[model samples]
Target chain A: MTSLGGDRSIGRLLASLALAVGGMGAGAVWAPSASAKPPAPAAFCQTYPDSKSCTTGFAECATCHTTAPARNAFGAQLSERLAPGTPRPLSDQAFVSALPSALKMIEGLDADEDGFSNLAEIRAGTRLASAESFPKVMACAPDQASKSGDGRWNVCGYDPNYAFRKISLDFCGRSPNRAEAEAFRKIKGEAAQKAALGEALDRCLVSKYWLGSNGVVWNLANAKIRPAFVIKSGANPGPVPLGDYDDDYNLFTWAHSGDRDVRDVLKAQYFVRRVSDDPVKLEIIPEEEVKKRGRATAQPVPADKRAGLVTTRWFAASNTMFTAIPRTTAAQAYRAYLGWDIAKMQGLLPVSDEPHDYDRKGVGAPECAVCHTTLDPLTYPFTRYNGIGGGYTYDDDRLKAYIRGDGPNVVNAPKSGIILGKPVKDLVEWADVAANSDPFAMNVVRDYWKVIVGREPEVQDEEEFSRLWRGLKDPARYNYRVERMLHDLVLTTAYGRP
Target chain B: MTRTAFIPALALVAAMFAAGCSSLPSAGSEPAQVASIDPKVKFKDGDRYLGDLARALNMPRETVCKELGRYDCFSDAFRIVLGGVEAPNLTVHTPLEEAALTAPIALDRAALHVCTSRVRMDREDPANAVLYRASASGRPDKAWMETTSNELYGVLLNRDPTKAERARLVGFYKDVATEQGKPNPDAASDWVTLSCFALASSLESIFY
Candidate 1:
């Protein structure tokens, strides 16, 4: 598996260098001002020949014209820097002459070489700059706006008139008002574009195999939530990156393959056996004999890594490597076994726990709430989606109804799902928890802001919650609120904390 | 000549234009006559006094031409009727007054039945009325257009309160068509109603 794609670490280095160098010129050039003079307001009005009804108002003109030029400039720069061989620059006068043409040009520039254009990257704000980058882009679009076509871009399921898609999708129709849309676009570019595409790809991969639909949907709530069922059932499951998809199955498949060169089964054994405190009472199974009896039963880890296979039945089990090793003192044994100090191993425990299906037996282990309680409750209001990437599985009837406008009402509707012992509901309720009961969402925000701004926010930053709420409430303030939050967090004393 | 002579003339022209003539205007006429008419209860074969009035008033061919969202009000017709109406002084005169100036001979009350289309057609022409074209274009000088469109809107209101378009056009003319800086109630209703219709249409286009 390691030899499948040899280390291309050099590619990552070059890309990271390009981003750092490009930052100096790119950031300064495309920055749009809320107060800037709008371009071509009167020109748009002139389309109506007989009546100047659409013309003669500066405010009205300002609505559409504010960002056209800026968007054009952004496109121009992107074209020149990313794909010089392309005939047109994004911000060229020719590009501006017809918005559709400009979008077409941007769509053609596959900066990531993942069969998707940078325009898709910009829209989803993912790093699909290369084949490796494809995973991030795939993880982002999933069910909504999934790309399909032999050689061209054609998205299904996403509304063409969706505000975000309006500028990036069609480009031919009337453009979004600059005041409202530009800021959001800039914010997206800044956050997603900063990372090397490969790194972004890697993160996307990690998210897919581990986080699954619940995680992806949570991430997508910041952009838009199309349907709760989309995530819940693992329906279309939009554009998750190929690398993440690949990584997720590769690790699992390797463990079960019975190949000695591969160390995956050993890895699982290390995770399970090392976490036990009382090894003497635990059961341990060897992989060699288990593979020999593979057809009849689940396999077990090799005896070398297993601590007490003969004395106790408590052990780990995998579909290939080991399924489970149940012992009377399994819980106690699990706590005592650790290669590293218990305190240092706590962080690793979050990902290391074997997924338990509470449904399989009458008694079920604690689930998402164990780690996500604080995060889930706090961040609930910020978004209202779960079971993101592969969680949504829709039947034929639901699909037909959705297209016909007779589908389930996913937006602002009550939801019921068991994450732990309790059934969590809507975004508002989620927000309530985040604001009051949960601190993880805020911590995530804090961490994200710190990374963005190069510093942490102070206790006084609590007041920013209201400010952020107010700004987000006014759709016009999207770009500003995000930037201000970044600026405040970075420039403050609190953000600098480790 | 007796008033009956005009009946044949009205019928002949209605037939020529393929307009409904029988049910609309009464064949017998007295030059200064005024009769209350129901807007609803479609006069399937009613007289299309519009063409007669258009011809009588010499309304421009362009004004009578149809376009998407173009022929909304009397002022819109005024533009086509009056050649090169100024934008600044659009509200200076009413649709009737502007029509009076453009086609003085058509002002006789006997021609009122035929005048509706003429006025509407004139409003459609950019040349005839000042405020009209601007108003339709969503321009700043829409006030005058609002005023005239409103007045014509008034005519529609009075003729048939329950007419199919009465409520819709009335709502838009009142709420949306009028100019921003200044508001005129008389024409405001119609102007706003039309403007609202335009807005609603735009929203529908984007969403649906």
Candidate 2:
């Protein structure tokens, strides 16, 4: 149940701060005072040039700093050395005078006390603030050393040839041919063999089998919910086949195949569809037009209306029930997108004392409000979107009927909602909040880690997991490119070992 | 009746009895001492196994699938039942019923049909000239059998057979040839048939 382990407590604390300071705006709350004497930018920048505060990239200071003045362990250490204030242009002399002391102070400190020194963590591109984040240094058993004194087999515990075969089957969905196997075996020396194996993995990632058949992209999507054209029929009519589901699959395949940013899954303004021809070409359609096409044709929706996979017809159909205001839809979104299941109260949101009833009373009552406080508000924006039967519509009357009770005037129905304690007027704002949230990135990393390692990442893996997450978020490195993430994963000790 | 006529009838009956006895093993005799080959290889599921088979045989997957009766051979034979509601790519995660009653039966039937067809198609083709030569060499010697066994092992198991294994398989081939009779014109085809069966039904061939 505790997937994140002891780090969950720390994560909970950050979540609380994020929610409590939600209204103040992330930048406003985190930004240091402008009037205070600014730090020597050149000194900090020169030392940790790749740090977000020092660079203009996706992974910035805010990644670790939930609030700037109140920094996390990593941020605090940096702030102490660099001088606590907003970064500003400083003279070279002033920068040089401050650089040595700050660097010296953090040199030997294990800020999070995860055993790894701050310098080691920084050099390894691991998080210094989180005890959970550290490099995994694998130790080999003494008996495993080869006669030739090559420790490769000792570390990996798998014959390079067998490892290559397994990697090919797992990544490419088939075994290597005789020629391919021979070519791989012909490579002499452990280093050369390892390099060749890595190159083979890279080639497999782009193979037709990986792209079309048993590829990671499709498997990742399937793991969430099987891409279905129709749900089974019982008392209610089965959800009809919407061409959009196939479009969703094609879009995912295209993104991953192209090695494009995977964050576009939640943030892209267009959906891709393959044209029916001898040599098919994928076309991107706008969100509004896609909605108008319904299940009749494949097209893109307008940028503002699109919410990546969340707004897809298949997603809505799979998650929603017959009822108009499908609370399950919101719950699924929270679990899938944010990586926290509301039913389990994983986020540990505060409970307030109030009376209970189904008519607003239940939502506000102290006992019921424990979960509904977050659940109801989170579901408010979803009321605009109807269930499977309604398809994808923005009709106000349909929205009203859905939120209100079917028979009567339900004045108690929520008119607005909050996401991670941030107020959202409607689903668009909700999507924006969900898309840019830290939980979104963390969830993605968690999912990918599971796919690559074939197991749920334990608490011990939090440091490496965070590094992967940071890389995905950092536009400078991978930037939400899943292929790059997969490449990184294949090269990990976990992937190489049994 | 004449004594000559009676003697001729007795001789004809003796010849028939002798032929029948030759076909059957002697009473209290042990079964043919066939070598037991256990590669300790586990079975791959339908898709992977079929893909491997097609690649190793240099045949199109569609042809192999069709010859094996498609789903019956690949899915039902392997117990990968694709129910009406099941997705095509949804892998059945249950452990394969390697010891199930029907497993051997199904494997035998499919391997016999496919391997026979593959041998028949390749026998006359120049591409399989080595296989044809080995089969048609009248009587296989130790060196030839060893070479053939190694080649077959490479194709099926992706490795060379050990000296003991090659010797055992060659002994099997010799026994098969001797049982078919020396003057049998179909001796080559029968040898190839048994060899194909051995490769196809092998633990190495069935498993990864």
TM-score of chain A of 2: 0.63
lDDT of 2 at A381: 69
**Tens digits of per-residue lDDT for model 1, B152-184:** 433321111223233333333333323343454
Give per-residue CA lDDT, model 2, range B1-208, as digits (tens): 1333323322432343234334422212323211111111234445566667677777677666543355546544454421111232343222333355566566656655655566666666756643435434555666667777787767766776655556556665544443323443444555555565566666546543
Highest-scoring model, DockQ: 2
The lDDT per prediction is 0.27, 0.54
Model 1 DockQ reads 0.00
TM-score of every candidate: 0.17, 0.62
Docking quality of model 2: it rates as incorrect
For candidate 2, lDDT tens digit of each residue in A28-91?
3222212211233334445666542222212223323543324687656755666446265444
TM-score of 1: 0.17
Candidate with best lDDT: 2
> Which lDDT value does model 2 have at B25?
26
